[model samples]
Target: MLFNSAESQTVNIYLDDSSTPAYSVAGCGRQNDNRGTVVLTSGKTGTVLVGVCSGENACALMSQAIDISPPSDNSCVGVVASSTAGGDTNSAYVILTWKATS
Candidate 1:
């Protein structure tokens, strides 16, 4: 899902990776605060791809690397928004795709 729109606002998307879901991230961006990309691998092993777009107030977009190792069977993750220099207000979006890798 690629979430995009208001640059000054903030939105949160919940994830359930209890079954270990593989993924390819793109689109869904962030603003104001950092974005959280959680990858849960319980009973299976998977991955998460995150795309942090640029917001209005923020000077730039969030491009961070979030990964998992050892093939997690159970875990969680949270990517905080990147602190930009200038305070503009040009919102952005992010995209995420999860698939069971059992």
Candidate 2:
């Protein structure tokens, strides 16, 4: 899921080795929460790339490696990424969560 706080920006999400975004969310002006799911084999790992764009130009970029593992029973695991120092104004953040499905 992506939670974009920047009032006039857009957040783009990309999966490993992909040149195109897998998901995109407009800033608070349009939407606040955008969610998606990616399923990977157990013990598999990949990269997540994020682009914060102001119009057609990128204002900030972030990347991280992600490892998939089942969460505890009845619980979800989450990872968060924030742009800028202390997540100042015009910054965007993403929360990636993992949970086991029946």
Candidate 3:
């Protein structure tokens, strides 16, 4: 994410559930644009929290949730459980018809 302010301020980035900030960057947007980024290790999943603070007075401008999911192998497409195709039956078939146009 990117942040910018008319006045000078301090930027902070916190990781996971910790109150302590993992990164603290100086200077505000009017002087220069600040960018924040984080990387998740293998086998990490579920909801994570990210927060941004702006200005010299130290006010929290934004908070966001980051969700992580396991990587896919691309073997097959997954289907939603709640969808239906008209009516259900013991067997189903898909048919295709094509006609040639002169």
Candidate 4:
């Protein structure tokens, strides 16, 4: 989750078995757990850490994302999720938090 603009270096740290970690929200800006991707904007650029949280926890989230830099805003993901239990439909409430460190 660190990016060095000086050398144009980027790193995304992933934990566990590729399953999104659930973060708890006790205060504000807690991760959203449902299923979705994030796209950075506003002239910002860097690595984005995607996190997902459960409905019963605070600051608890399961997150992961690709180290991508789209020339015209591309390499999108999770635009659709399983409405059921096996990713078979579109799942809403899936929020994504992104930080573009430039």
Candidate 5:
């Protein structure tokens, strides 16, 4: 994540229809140590929700449904998730990359 503002941002990741986040991080924009691994069955689709906040207000939010279809010969694939916050003037960005092990 790219942090431009003085205050750090919080990021939360939710899978499916769960009300609680599957993963969460505080002060995420300040460092590069934020990372996690999730396993999903191949040949299936799932919804992912990502939310970013600074204090009591929300800075960014995104939700997308992804299909996990690995090659017949490959056991893993790379996936990248990206989003931006704080609008045009003072925007911050979050990027997440991981290897999908199906």
Candidate 6:
């Protein structure tokens, strides 16, 4: 989402329908630095909302919702840690540490 103001502002990103912001960015402006992104990984269906405001006022200059769905079962996503024999870190096979829920 875009922050329309020229001055540095605070951008809030909310997940689902909660009143509190899940993430907040300070000192943001309308220039190339205004853009931001948040990763949604609740493992459930929900909507992402973004609110941009400036200064002491809590008003939102712009707000919108982005719908999100659960990730597909066929998708492969995880963290991998590897190490070679004799505690050697030169080479090792990559491993997927995250297990599938379903």
Find the candidate with the highest TM-score and give its number: 5
Q: Write the per-residue lDDT of candidate 2 for residues 1-102, one digit (tens) a residue.
A: 555555456666677777877776665432546645554322334566666765555665454545545524343334444444334444455655445466
- Candidate 2: global Cα-lDDT? 0.53
For model 3 the local lDDT of residue 40 reads 36
After aligning candidate 3 to the native by TM-score, how far in Å is the CA of 29 from where it should be?
2.8
Ranking by TM-score: 5, 2, 6, 3, 1, 4
Model 6: residues with Cα > 4 Å off, grouped in runs = 1-6, 34-36, 42-45, 58-102
Once all C-alphas are superposed, what RMSD does model 2 give against the true structure? 6.7
Model 1 lDDT, residue 52, Cα? 43
Candidate 5 residue runs with Cα over 4 Å from true position: 1-4, 28-45, 61-92, 96-102
Total clashes in model 6, counting residue pairs 3 or more apart in sequence or in different chains = 0
Q: What's the TM for model 2? A: 0.47
Candidate 3, poorest ten consecutive residues by summed lDDT: 89-98
lDDT of candidate 5 over 1-102, digit per residue (tens)? 445444555666677777788777665434334444444322234556667776667764443334447534333222233334445222344454345455
Q: Alpha carbon lDDT of residue 71, candidate 5?
A: 34
TM-score of each: 0.27, 0.47, 0.36, 0.22, 0.48, 0.42
Residue 3 C-alpha lDDT in model 5:
50
Name every residue pair that clashes in candidate 3: none
* Highest-lDDT candidate: 2
Go through the candidates in order and give each one's C-alpha lDDT.
0.37, 0.53, 0.32, 0.28, 0.50, 0.41
Better of 1 and 2 by lDDT: 2
lDDT, residue 79, model 2? 40
Clashes of 3: 0
Angstrom error of the Cα, residue 84, model 2: value is 10
Judging by lDDT, tell me the better candidate of 2 and 4. Answer: 2
TM-score, prediction 6: 0.42
For candidate 1, what's the RMSD?
Answer: 10.1
lDDT of 4 by residue, 33-94 (tens): 32233333322223334442223222223334444565434343331111222232212233
Model 1 segments more than 4 A misplaced: 1-45, 56-73, 85-102
